[model samples]
Target: MFSFRFSNGPAAALLTAAVLLTVPGCTGPGAGQAPATSGPASGGGSPAGTASPGPPGVFPVPAATLSIPQVVKDVEPSVVTITTQTGIGSGVIYRGDGSIVTDAHVVEDQQRQPFKSVRVQLADGTQTNASVIAIDDPTDVAVIKADRSNLPAARFSTATPEVGDLTVVIGTPLGLEDTVTSGIVSGLHRNMPPSREQPQGALDLIQTDAPISPGNSGGAVADATGAVIGLSEAYLPPSSGAVAIGFVTPSATVTNVADQLLKNGKASHAVLGLVPADLSPEIVQRFNLATTTGALVIQVSPAGPADTAGIRAGDIITSFAGQKITQVTDLLAALRKAQPGQQVDLTARRGTDTKTFTATLANTSNTG
Candidate 1:
């Protein structure tokens, strides 16, 4: 995970909580009981590159005490090496057949360069040329089916994670093969920016300190049960380090959306028909912030929800259907609580006066 400056800080826990993942009590390390499995090669940097181990006292969450040699033996056959003829990444077997899950950006034409071919290298030393089965570009998740079925499958956790469980990341980073890293779940309920690299507005993600690298995308993050929890994504770089601070996509979201792609090659979502932005504390002061809370409205789409609701520019959102809006993330989170065609009661501030309006949510579609 990337590091944020801690000098003038929030709390020691907040720094640890960033790049956060939800960790369950018994699944993490040192809160007392010994770990049943111990996994290693943990810390920031590409699975192939190294700067230095985490500052002396920083220890890793216990990986399955199960030995790496054994893990490789049991899991490697299912853990295939991926190469795009020009790029590299890792994948996980999601079914008994040869179907694998990896980052969409890892397999398709990305902003960096278009991929020529994506080949999977099996553990038996057999290499097979593969084609994309489907991709969820919105979420940056992709699925590729091998030529055969009856393949070994990775395990997934059916249980929900707590706030402090140990999290393990397994991947082939920076072109390296079968690497592992560890860290605590920093925090949860996160949302990342939408961009060319990531189309799906960042959904629920498991924040972790586990070291992630270039090749780690689409790799697995499992709990102590050896059940998959999330898919490794990008690193959140600390303003200070050359190495990146990493993130992962939650497995639940992956499972929910992948099936749709395989079935129809696309998914549907809702669009607000507006661009949201942050309202700085300074701006809050100048505008008297209505109530010092809510997403700041910079622009309203013509004939869109805001305009239809009679909302205008410079209005700071104070509440959404009765829920307080502190930031853009808060508003987005609230959006999920509603459905298309439903009325969304919005409260905004224009100077010292407060007002509320109702805008009907719109249904939108996405294919990744």
Candidate 2:
């Protein structure tokens, strides 16, 4: 099994205690344990029209390049230190009206409730009381409102950064405010496995080599141009001792979810409402099935799209929308890429027979 650290920033003992008591089936990484898996590429390649310079890092840094100090000066003010009763993390000023955006897990207490009185500390050492406006649990995004205004909102870029592009992480790790670390965009669109805290899992994650430690959660991962490209989330450590790998939520997804939370009081996502298990050779042989690859429906939500469409347990899902469903991840990625109220075709294998069904996705946030 793959292992990862959520990178929450609290002292190891406190974090472990809190997590064990609250997050069911989720365990924090021990000192020497390393990640068991590798992540997908972030599409790092030479820019179009620019000749490949043999390989990355072959060319020297340009003389006029913006220094690390310049990046810190340009973006530090917009990053804030977020403290809850149980943990400390980071946040970015979302708008001028005193709204802040951070990882939902950062502001939530062990019970997953928004802390009654969260505190936001500005770069100037100004502390303001904030209230949770909305929390998107599935996506791990949250919006909070503070009493103060005229905050410096961080500039966000929807353009995905190329792999090898400079990535800077600004956050309050270990309670140290305005700390900055630099690395390259290692990969993008990586789909991390689901956890009890986030059952839907994190999709389209931007992977970087930046040292994202505890307290860097919800911090900003800015590109070389000083545009916010992603939000620091988690890291994977090498088991045998190697440089740890980090993951960030892309800025586009963060902005989109934040906007939805601001406007609709919740972030909406397409839901099929079915519990799925990966189909394997053993399962197929035991059940005497036809295909080796696909997701086997183990449970279906009543009145949800999947159930209403006549999908049943023991059925192997072969395809969803236009995407082939070889495993549970493919189905999840396809659903995440779709929108609510969208109708799509679903193919499944039932007792040596293949059946097709139409399903209209719904928002679990809005629907029962």
Candidate 3:
């Protein structure tokens, strides 16, 4: 199933490899995480008559430290809660003109229905109506427009965030408005498999340890200084004892897609127009392939880039552009970094023969 939020309330649902869980809401791709207020505050009040700790006993530092709480206060206003007819999720104000950015899966109905009216809850709890302007399903990004103005637009950082950098996620998670969770950037360039909502899947996702629940999708993932580094996307549930892995769309991609959507009503992504399968021992034996790694071309669209480059269905793509392609995801990752009309080199194997070709990229939305 797609990862969009479900119509039901926020609760962790059992998920199978086939069923993609949404952030929360109705049980789709993205909603938000559970509430951050799961427990009582630490260091509860001291006894009424107890005196403050003496100097030798070590007095608590007052206003002597910088903290994330201050960052939250500064950044929360740019995050918002988005509710459609069937689901609820989060979004970020991308422009003062009332343009908002969110996960496409959030507003996507069960049947991949057309855009519909949505209610946006701002940080101050003010509500406004919005219209879906453009959606890029391949990247799971969408842009919407509201009639209102003077919105709190989020500021983004251009500097790349390193692994282990402090991070905080802000969103309307678990139906909780303006929730904030803290963690660190744990990884980068993570590739997620295709789901019902994203046919080609998402590439180069920012991985974090922050608590991202069902409603967290489309929310802001800020650095320690409060500059948005990415947009919360999805989180991985415990598997084989592994836990707390969340993902986000990096700020660079967000800016590029949002800019394109605002300007052209759609975002452009390079397309190969071919079906690819990962090379494995089973696939190797089944297809009598020449290699046990790389992406196998199963079908090439007529007149598409691969077809025009003389790539056949039986060819194994070993590399694309300047990167080595070990699987279909590698090809996808490379494609995301390219633009339409860009020429890229490809290396493939046909039987025992290895050949190279240059293919011009094309936009999937343009072709369709």
Candidate 4:
């Protein structure tokens, strides 16, 4: 297997363009996002006692404050309900020519959960048969292709969002056709292990406070102006003792994963073979460390490349290559951009001395 090199330029621009041209939809990350229309606003009806009838969602987006009716009318065409013989999910249109993306678990058998045939139901309730055009299970994403062209595509966002922003979630969740919910972004660079629900792998989930349901999988989670920023994957169950928490795969991750699917049906991520902990102020005070922030290597995997390079616990990783490591995800983003097996330089602080080391990469499940 070969290492991956996904430059975050060309395709990212295309995704941004698609989103800017699209209208407001729905969202649900973990916290801090635009508010959603409370309760499914029924149909293209005006809000209680409001004389003017707005678009389907009634959310103010872009140039004019688009009404609920306008949002529904503009974005509905691009929200496709994906269902297969094995499972069902959602997919937002990415191109005008019937190219859409959804969670790979809903379409691929990488986990041996067989999918016989896939079908996409448009917002108009028109169902078109589709096939697996591309898939990358490491990211739990897949792209579907159909014979139809000139279809409506959803909008995408380029800026990395801040926590505490309003979020809107739109999908046919749990088989619910065309349902939209609202919430706020709570956390950023959330690294969570997979559960019984999400089967691909650990994800750097964008945590939101939106209401996500079973059928909400693979839906578009966007911010103000109806531009997508993340893809809904899982939600904190009501019984989990959590308040309106939802999880999403960030747009940056989505763009990389989607391009791989469109190109070779898969994508790869670099692995450092160590679990990292962000050294917060409290930890700094306890350790009386030099810098207030840096990534502390907690455990090094015995079989990982980092372990082979003699990376050990108690090593405070301050930087990777030339990029400063303010957080683990920051390092993750940088590594994802680097090709596996490629040499990487790091600045580590052991006690009072700063050191540098070079490590070769490793690839697993077709990616590194």
Give all candidates' CA lDDT scores.
0.57, 0.70, 0.69, 0.60
Please give the lDDT score at residue 315 for candidate 3.
90
- TM-scores, all candidates, are 0.70, 0.82, 0.81, 0.64
Candidate order by decreasing TM-score = 2, 3, 1, 4
Q: Which of the two, 3 or 4, has more TM-score?
A: 3
Candidate 2: worst-modelled 10 consecutive residues by lDDT: 12-21
RMSDs, each prediction? Answer: 12.8, 8.0, 10.7, 12.2
Superior by lDDT: candidate 2 or candidate 3: 2
Query: Mind giving the per-residue lDDT tens digits that candidate 4 earns over 1-368?
Result: 11111110011110110001110112221123222222110001111111344688895432333444455555566787776543346788877777787765556432323254577888878889887776654555667786688787777665567787767778875467788777778998664421222211234678888777654667778765566777776655545455676778777677777877677655655666776666768888898988766778877777576787777888888888799987655665566567667888888898899988888766543222
Between the candidate structures 1 and 3, which one is better when assessed by lDDT?
Answer: 3
| Model 1: worst 10 consecutive residues (lDDT sum) | 8-17
Pick the lDDT winner: 2
In model 3, the Cα lDDT at residue 254 comes to 77
Tell me the deviation in Å of residue 11 in model 4.
30
In candidate 2, what are the lDDT values of residues 81-114, reduced to their tens digit?
Answer: 8877665678888787888888777776555666
Superposed by TM-score, candidate 2 places the C-alpha of residue 133 at a distance from the truth, in angstroms, of 0.8
lDDT of 3 by residue, 1-368 (tens): 11322233322321211111223222222345333322100000111111345588687542122279977986799898888765567888888889998877676665554367788989888899999988765556778887789887887765567899888998876676788999998998987654333335557878898887766778888876667887777765443243677788888777777788888888777777677766768888986876888878877878887789898887998988879988777887787788878999999999999999898877766555
What value does the lDDT take at residue 218 in candidate 1? 72
lDDT of 1 by residue, 1-368 (tens): 12222110011110110011111000112123232221111100012111234667987553344443444454455666677633466777877767787766567542322244578876566778777877644455677877767777876553456667667777776556777777767767666533222222354666777786556667777665456676776564344453434567766666765766677765444445555556767987786665666666776667766678888778878788889887766676667546667887888888788888988866544100
Model 3, TM vs. native: 0.81
Best by TM-score: 2
